[model samples]
Target: MRRVLHVTDCYSTGVGRAVDTIVGLSPEHEHHLLWAGEDDPAGKGFASTTALPGSSLARLRAVRAAVRATGADIVHAHSSRAGVYARAVPAGAPVVYQPHAYKLLDPRLPRAARTAVAAVERALGGRTDRVVVLSEQEARLAARLSPGAGRTVLPNVPSLASPGVRAPQPDGPRRRRVVMSGRVSPQKDPGWLAETAERLRERDPAVEVRWLGSADDPELTARLERAGVSVSGWLPADALVAELTAAGVYLHSAAYEGFPISVLDAAWCDAPVLAREIPAFAGTGLLTVADPAAAADRVLEVLAGGAVRERALQGARDLLREMNPQVQRQRLAEIYA
Candidate 1:
């Protein structure tokens, strides 16, 4: 079995879920994780996991040291921060950098900050043997970074050993709640979700909107809570799946993404998705609109139950047919080969 070393500086949300999908898809390969984050190591089936150092220079050194210690054949780094560490290392293993979402694409970052990040990414781009991306939009961004490295798009699909996605129960009662998953952060755009929630509440105070993850920003959580959106802080897989499967609709409000795993989770659980019109959702066939007001209106129309809701549900299921995990595995085999 090929010994693959997985490195990530982010373990809380998107990057964490992306890694889960990758490692779970190829269990035949031995996987080792080296992470530097507040959360304890949570590997799906890692042979081992090591903690990276606290400082930036130390973390870079630790990445080099871990490569030697593990004798890894391939180094897969998730997120831009870990990409820096992995690409900068002199280790001889092939390096694949997967930016869950480019920091340059984040709407909240300052212009100067983005420019600096872009410069750093371009500097290290040649060191990456292959840059794995999730969508065409992200692929274009990676190409702009540097022309030297090869680019591949591996769409995020639900991994194995997950809570079985309940088949779409057309005759059964669907829960009234509209839900979203992923940590509350600027990228997830809790502010916009809060605005949408308020609009939802104004129309129908009884509307139940729920968030299914922990808070990265307490202030954002407060905004959501004040808007009458209930936050279910970090449910386990089964419970989270149960929530998604029963919800009236899944809402994806992320301002930027490389195809969030949470959206795939909703699709897997047969929850109709009403998502923002970001490039990530571009050709995915989810019921999408350009603005929060339109999204809020769409959610209400969907909840009322009719052709609109039925079409959304059907579209979500059709999308799922294309996102089959086994097919994803076949493609992944090509990447790892």
Candidate 2:
């Protein structure tokens, strides 16, 4: 059996699901995953995964040991930290790095740190076999940073099954639901989302907002609660998908992204989108907006009538078929083999 090792700092449910699909199709491929700090329950059966010590050095050492033990032919790493650690593993295995979003996009990262990462990519990229990206925009960015390596587009993999949904319309005139899901850091900018929701509420008092994400900011959570937005941190996959399907409209309030799995989830659930006009988010037939207030207006307009919702749902369904996880895995098999 050909062995592969996937390394990442943390395991997202989306990532776990994708890995599961890959393993299902190509059982001949023995896959092992390693991450830092703690094991993710969602990652079970995706591969035999190990959670290493928190320190970078310790994590790298553990990954190296896994590489040796697995006799891996390819090392696939996700995120910047994992990419660096994958590179540190012995050169016997071909290395492939998948950066969901480049480390430079992190708002908390220092400018110097960003520059240093770029320099390191430039230096080590030649030794790397391929850099896989979830969007064409990310592929372009990777090419610019590591001109010596091959940049391959391997778009995000979303589930094929429809998200079962249910909801109660709150007691009000314009009872509509708006949903946003992601990590609640500055990149996601929950403040902007709250502001957008406030504007929507002005036009329609019954407009309700829900956000599902890792709550990185306690102050933001308090502020959102004050503004009447329901915030839930790290929901299970089934519950999260149900919420996406129940939402009258899904909002993509991110500043930047390679290709957000949440947007794909919304599409899979036949949910309409009022999304920021980012290059990666193009072609989803969403109500694109530059202004947050205008975004709010668009969302309200789409949710006001059942006919509009029906039309939007059809569009979302079309997009969902185009990006199905099974088809995406077939594509990856071609790339990997």
Candidate 3:
């Protein structure tokens, strides 16, 4: 059996979920996780190592020691920060680096800072055995940023109790509620969501916009509330699933994304999805809206009851088929082999 060591600094977001999925789905392989934070999401079955918050050099030393102690055959790193540390260390194992989303793509960063990050990534490319991305657009971006890097696509799959199970829709009038799930950050474009919520509220007084996750920005959360958006701060998994199941539509207005797991969850839950026209979702067959206003209009249309909602639900089913976990498992095995 191949021993794999998965390294990650952030264990609470999409990166964490991806790592969890990989370990959980691939039971044939021996997986050891090296998490930098105290929150141990790797529950029961696997061996784990934790590192206290420290300088990069200190963390690198800890990771290197972990690699040797575990005698891992392959070292897989998740997210940007962990990628930096994992690629920098001479771990004596093949390194697989998956940057859930490249930091250089963050619009909040200044141009020069983005360029510098690109340079660092390019320099680190030689150390990476495989650069796994969530989508084709991400692969192309990685190629441009880090020329000569070996890149591959391994889409993130949702973790559902029953992989293909569909939620039953109520027969009566649908709730005039729209939901968005994810951490409220600049990438999610909370400002646009706030604007859209106000417009949607004006268009239909009964329309309620609910955000299922918490925001790092208190001011942005307050702004969304003022604009008549219900901010449900970070619901537990079962609760979040319940919210999505009850909602009429799922609206995603991210400025950019690698592959949003929440979108995948919505698709699995059979929620009608209306997302921004971003490259990351280029061929996912998801309905795309140009702006928040357009998204709001789409939500209104769905709430009004028509073929649009049916079409969107069909599209979501198609998306779920493409992201099938069994298919993903085969692809992952090929890569690891």
Candidate 4:
């Protein structure tokens, strides 16, 4: 069996789930994970190490050492940071790099920083055997960043193993709640969430909103709380799933994304999803809104119970089927090959 080393600096987000799925499903190949971060759920089995730190130089050195120690035949680097580090190291192993999302596309960054990151990505493209992206938008961005780089589109699939119990639609009067999961950072547009919650509460004081993730910014956390939105800071998977299942609707307001796993989870849980009209979510069949007000309206429509709600739920199911794990497994095997 070919020994494949998976290297990543981020092991807490959707990227972590992708890594876990790859290693868990592909038993034909020996997998080793060299990762950085505490509480990395993906580093549970097989040969693994957390020697790499987040710093560029440190991660490069650590990855090189891991490659030498493991004698890895193929090296798969995940996330932009790890992708840069792993590609920088000329370890003679075939390298596959997957940038969960391009750093250059982040609008929060300064123009100069974005340009510099793009230049770095272009320079490193030659070192990568293949560049894997999760969406068509990302594939297009990758091509622009590196003109002739070998590329593959491997869409993310929801993990079926931890499918949460679907909460039955309420037959009687019940508390209405809208839920969202992910880190409360600029990327997620916490400001928009806070504003949306305030608008939603104004329309219906009884309506409640909850964010099931850790707060990266204290100011944003306070804003959300002040807006009458409950922020559950990073619950365990089971607990988060339970919270999601109980919710009447799922809302997503990310400024950007490679592909959101939480949206997939919400769809699998049968919660009607109303997400922002972002390129990443285009053609996913989920109902998309332009702004927070539109999102709130969509959620209210789902809660009201009618043909709209039924259609939304059906759309969620269709998306879940489209993102089947078996199809992902086959595509992954080809990429690995």
Which candidate's lDDT is highest? 1
Q: Each model's RMSD to truth, in Å?
A: 2.1, 3.7, 2.3, 2.5
Model 1 TM-score relative to the real fold:
0.93
Instruction: Report the C-alpha lDDT of model 4 over 54-129, residue by residue, as the tens digit.
Output: 5778778888788888889888999988887888768568888899878765767898888888889989988888
TM-score of model 4 vs. true structure: 0.92
lDDT leaderboard ranking: 1, 3, 4, 2
What is the alpha-carbon lDDT of model 1 when measured against the actual structure?
0.82
What are the clashing pairs of model 4?
none
Model 2: colliding residue pairs? none
Determine the C-alpha RMSD for candidate 3 after optimal superposition of all C-alphas.
2.3
Better of 1 and 2 by TM-score: 1
| lDDT tens digits by residue: candidate 3, 1-337 | 7889888888775677777788777888888888764246645357765653578887787778878889899989888888888888686788888999887666678888988898889888878888889888889887876666678788788654333434444445446898988888888888888888988888888888989887768887888889888889867666777788888998897888898888988887778888888888787788888887788888888877779888778877888777878877887887688
- Ordered by TM-score, highest first, the candidates read 1, 3, 4, 2
- Looking at candidate 1, what is the lDDT of residue 176? 74
TM-score of predicted model 3?
A: 0.93
Please provide TM-scores, in order, for all candidate models, with all chains considered together.
0.93, 0.87, 0.93, 0.92
Worst 10 residues of 2 by lDDT: 162-171
Residue-level error in angstroms, candidate 2, position 146: 2.2
lDDT accuracy of residue 170 in candidate 2: 27
Question: Candidate 2 lDDT, tens digit per residue, 3-36?
Answer: 8888877666455445555555566677887865
lDDT for residue 332 in candidate 2, whole number 0-100: 75
